[model samples]
Target chain A: MQIYRFEDKKPFMEKLEELLKSGFTSRQLEIYLPHPDHEIEELVEEYWPKSKLKFITLAGGLSGCSAGFAFTIFTSLDWPLITSGKPLVSIPPYIVIAFELTILFGALFSLGGFLLLSRLPSFKQIFHPEEYGNEFVIKILREET
Target chain B: MSHKDTGVVNQEVNAKSAAQVKDQMERDILAAIKKPKPVYWLGLLITITMTLIGAAAWAYQIKTGMGVAGIRNPVGWGVYITDFVFWVGIAHSGTLISAILFLFRARFRNRFNRSAEAMTVFAVMTAGLFPLIHLGRVWFFYWLFPYPTQRLLWVNFRSPLVWDVFAVSTYFTVSAIFWYIGLVPDIAILRRVRTGWQKLAYAFGSLGWKGTFKQWQHYNQIYKYLAALATPLVLSVHSVVSWDFAMGIIPGWHTTIFAPYFVAGAIFSGMAMVFTLVIPMRKFFRLEKYITVDDFEKAAKLLLFTGMIVGYAYIVEFCLAMYSGNPFERDQFIYRAVGDYAFTYWLMIACNVVTPLTLFVRKLRRNIKYLFIISFFVNIGMWLERFNIVVISLAHDFDPYAWGTYTPSIIEVAITVGSFGWFLTWFLLFSKTLPVLPITELKEEAE
Candidate 1:
């Protein structure tokens, strides 16, 4: 393989022109250099450009309310539950319990998904090591100056 | 004076280190599962056998009639009623941890939320069975509902049992839907990650999720809306549950305070149950890192706080009975301390009150074994609380002629055992079949 060297932008352009004239195409490809304008495009388009996001935070607000009401009703006394002159199945009071169970169940399900995805409690190997670090194959490509 | 290497942002190859960490975590999980001795299985088997015997007793009850149980005359409700109360309380902790904390934006919930939710669903299923089993002729149980039949009679929406029917039914439906919906993406991840039977099972559960952009968007929107709607329900369900007894005119039962008090106790007891299940779960599932000690600590502290609130309610009720100046009300309070059911009331006080206070010690709260011990005691206390509330009030009332002592027959105990077995069996199945965590969400959050 022949290496190309450039001392300045003029020489670099000349080398590129020579390569074009020589009808060069890259077959021994490893890594391609990035263009300057790509950064701007990425800034506008990427959903997560910096830190990798991990989980969806879920709060089961309404479901908790519904379940709480159900909990209240089931826990009450037998036969005619008319207390202190209130209606047997007081609608006004039951709302408190219905709400709690609803939210509770909702939050729980959310966690199940969150944990599985993160590979949590996965006390075994999931992925090979080389995939994460820049250890395998081409590390970097450089031009001589 | 200072030369810093700021240009080198990337670290040298850390492939080996990363691989080791990944492999270690995997190995640890496998080891965690393996560590639970065969004895645990033997215990489960014994429990199942006991449960089956209980089921046989239930078969006899079905054939002989509800009359076979001790309930009769003034004591139409006995052990079945107590069980209904107990199971409902057991079901409470999951929602209390998952929903209430979630609404408060507590991150501590993330650790054990999955297991807690599973417990809630199972507990509710067990709890729901009690009311139906209490009905002598389970076949005609549908008659309790208010529906238009050719005979032209409407159900008494006035019945607390009716409210209970609606409340528990709604809870089961909502909980079932919510639990399944939350598992969808996790199931898909499992489908992709697992092989053979696991892949097929996860695939079936995931219903062909492709991780499409559209799917994520829709899933997030629906989940958000459901959470908003479900938040209020957490309080509402338990409040309604309180009404089923608060509506009763019995001296102890008819108190207005029962609504909020019961709701608080439900949450308190429910939180304890979560600790009870979670301590073992993290160990069994190798979820120590995900469900950290911090979570266990927070939960234990919460159990203490609730236990105190419940204790306060107990004292307040006694004082209020005195203040009301009603001789009958005064006597009911006195009887609670020294009557046929006196042993139950005192035992309840010890279990629900004295025992849980032991958790006030920070060291005790942090210890998993101690937390497990205390959580179970909380459950016992809660169950007794329900027993005292229902049986004590019913067994003694305004008219001495109506006074009666009630004891649970063997049939009643059997059915309760069976219901618990059923719950445990379902959980066992779920553990084998599903990935208990949401992988996609974790990826997003962690990244």
Candidate 2:
């Protein structure tokens, strides 16, 4: 892995555009900035647009809702007792739990997906320039011949 | 120096080069984390002492039982529940500033969102303690959760208290994630800037963020959605909290307006707290350039808006009670204004409604001294408002024979004071550790 640091964004962008035009795969190059930039993100997205991130969040939320409903409804049935003279399978109140669980699992899945997709908690040292946090740096992984 | 003396508004925004902007932000914000003054330690010492006192009080209560807390059959929810509601209300503005303002693209929030979000987390932590303390059998607190037991026991899904458990816990989870996600880039900055133990800590906390466009893209996407998810919780959490009272059959507690009323009141109290905390912090941290009077004025406008909403809720509550001519509701409203606890009711009105009205004066809104003083009043008034709502309603219930006035015991008062100490300790520690200002976001705004 070769890391190049640029004091200005212009050189970084030019190098990025050159790398992209040369048909380098998105995985071969990583661009880091001091802060988020819309245009650069657009350029990155133009190359690597497909991501399965949302599916994890969606699946987690749906399952969370299902689990929440099952837990609340089944628990009442297990007891076979009524407190407020309402139906044993009271759906109105149970929806609160479902809603809460939906958010909880959705958030957890989204965070999990983010960590997994980003390959985070990365203990293995990669080529990261110290200036990358303040300035800009682009890292390119060389293909072994 | 007074912020006005700094002439922050006169500084030219467009004059600075990109490098200059970066340097200035780094110098100003990072100093708060790297340098500690004597005042910081003094404040920490005081808060720690208060927290210890509160813990001792809780210990005393546990040893003697709930009888030591002055709660009786009539006024069952006393200062502990009031403190719970007040702290929960104070937690609202953090989400409002971080999530709601981010959704609306309010640039002003960039300066103060980190501190506000931290307040939200700490305030919620403090608020969560009250329910446990109120539970005479503090050890039985886990029973609030729905877990299958040998007795086939389960929490009733029909209870608003159960809803509160889910709502508050989810709110905390989402808010904490939102807060931590926002910290990643800043933590990444600290990772490179610090050394030794601090470097290792930031290294782990930052999740190895590189400035890569790809990482930024994913971070931005996830953050946006988290903000989206948290927005509804800002409304729902407090609404569910209101239901804790609204679901009760007590005359004053059974109003349909409780949800919106409580939500508005929460935002109002929370904003006042933002003012209370930020005014002193900006001064102490010498962040006048970043957190200007203009920022305070904008927040004051919001404080005024929510304050008006709260004031309107109060009036509408009384009007509805009178118009309904339901003898029970009418009597309860009358009792609130003129009963034994009428001092608290009037105090709530004066602090929340009357004091906030002064902000309509442009001069007062911009004046730091006036704004700080008024915010202090609002904090006290909001606490009293919760006190009036919780205690007054229960005291003057439909059964006239059951009517009774109640006062908090010394233990309850100590715990209440301790809750502030606990909250302040976390906040003060946070200020010294994290960049109180969102350094990355502030730089983004500067550019």
Candidate 3:
């Protein structure tokens, strides 16, 4: 079994560089930390066909809001209504629609963000020797026995 | 030292201190959330009990009938409607503080954002409840929606009350969504920071967000877009609420001035509400450093500005009433000033006008105790402001025989108290569970 912690970029690269040069495959997993270089991720795909890897990325609030808004508005556009001799798509009335849509979207998006990132409804947390840290640790892992 | 040289040195020193104040301000905010409080969840308990009691009272009001409160021919909307306007008006400040300030690039909002955002959510929650509570048949409340039915019941499209259903519901939904969405990245941060149930909750809300470039790119784009969208809500929401009265045939309620008038008063009372909540929470949360004197001063400045507008509206209303030379309108204005409800009118003036006018002085703005005292009056004043608009208008019409008084029954008062409880409870729970401050948004602002 083997364990590697990705800290600074230089150390992480050096370790990966050694792995690439030495051709150490199998029974290993590189824990890809948050905001890991896309090229390195690409490299993993190119070089190691079956070697195990885990990835975690950091996301913020606005993204969640957008997603939620998009889901609600697009999904419910067909909702029927008539008022004020104005077009169903009038500006003044639509202002209300837009406001509600934006808010609903922002909320659901946040909830969605939490769900996607956190991997919730998760009851058991196993200390399976193979742990990855994206926040402070970046990458974490365990090698096969 | 030469006289000219002495003046120059003092000016330079003042400039140096001004620069120092900004730097100190930043460091102070950074220290605030980091310095933890004992995390007394008493607020959480109190708020819940209040919410449940509110719920029970609302349920009882519905089951018994609208008569459970003090609604009759003269006073159609007593506490419930007054509260609806009051709570909706209160909802204004959150968006004003968070969205308006952000658009204008005001850095002072950082300290109050979490509290303000939480305020928006709770205020809206409180507002949303009144509509249902006011609905004598709460069960059939959904009938207000323009849904196709076999019974062929369609909501009155011409009625401003129906417009209110659209405006208030939309405002609350969107604002709540905006508030929650802004909270996501912070939820992720909290997820990373804590363990056990806290971690679980944050993790759930964070939605597996990894804060990568693609995500941040999308997030920033969406946030900017949403901010743009939310800004107009500041105008539209209160205007729509005002339309509820404006569309009516009542002389005072039907005035064209209502839209702008209500919006101004909404903002005035809204700022006061924000002050009332922030003053206490800042102390309890030990957040004095972040929610600094500057933020309070700025808000007070806004409160005064709105107060002036409200005062202007008062003057204009009387002028309009007299100039129009309609005895009915003139009589209504007179009754409002010196009528049976005179005490409420005077209270409104004292809180919204005479008192907040003191805020023109910077010293009183920063005086926390004074802010709280004034804030209390502002609240009382703003509430009366709505009361006078709704009840007083109804009490005195063109016909003297219809003129009547409205006194809230015990149930009406209970429900109002319960709404406050509900609002506070939701807020307290939220503050503890979520990162009130949008750490990500603030980080962006700082940059």
For candidate 2, give the DockQ: 0.50
Model 2 clash number: 5
lDDT string, candidate 1, B1-447, tens digits: 121321111121133342233333334433442334675677578768767876898789888887889888777768787887777776767766656676686766766666677877888888887877787678888897645577654454445666677667656665565666667656654555457776665566766554322234335544554555455555556666777878777888778788678877887888877776667667777676556665677887888888888999999999989899898888899999999988989888898889888887777877789888877777778888888888888888899988988887777777767776777766665554554544333332221
Q: Judged by DockQ, which candidate is best?
A: 2
Note the DockQ of each predicted structure.
0.05, 0.50, 0.07
**Mind giving the per-residue lDDT tens digits that candidate 3 earns over B1-447?**
122212322243345442233233333333344434545456666767776776787777777788878889877877888999999888888888778887897867766766787887778878877888877677888887766677644554445566577667666766766676677656665566556876776676765555532344345444454566567766777888888888778878778888889888887887887777778767765665445566677778888898999999988988998787788888888888899989998888887879988988877877889998988898898898899998999988878888788899888887888888888777666655665555554433322
lDDT of 3: 0.66
Q: Model 2: runs farther than 4 Å from truth?
A: A1-4, A125-131, A143-145, B1-17
Lowest lDDT block of 10, candidate 3 chain B = B1-10
lDDT (C-alpha) at residue A118 in model 1? 35
Q: lDDT at B366 for candidate 3?
A: 72
lDDT ranking of the models: 2, 3, 1
Ranking by TM-score: 2, 3, 1
Candidate lDDT scores, in order, read: 0.62, 0.85, 0.66
Worst 10-residue lDDT window for candidate 3 chain A reads: A51-60
How many backbone clashes are present in model 3? 26
- Per-candidate TM vs. native? 0.73, 0.95, 0.74
Q: Score chain A of each prediction against the true chain A by TM-score and list the results.
A: 0.38, 0.86, 0.36
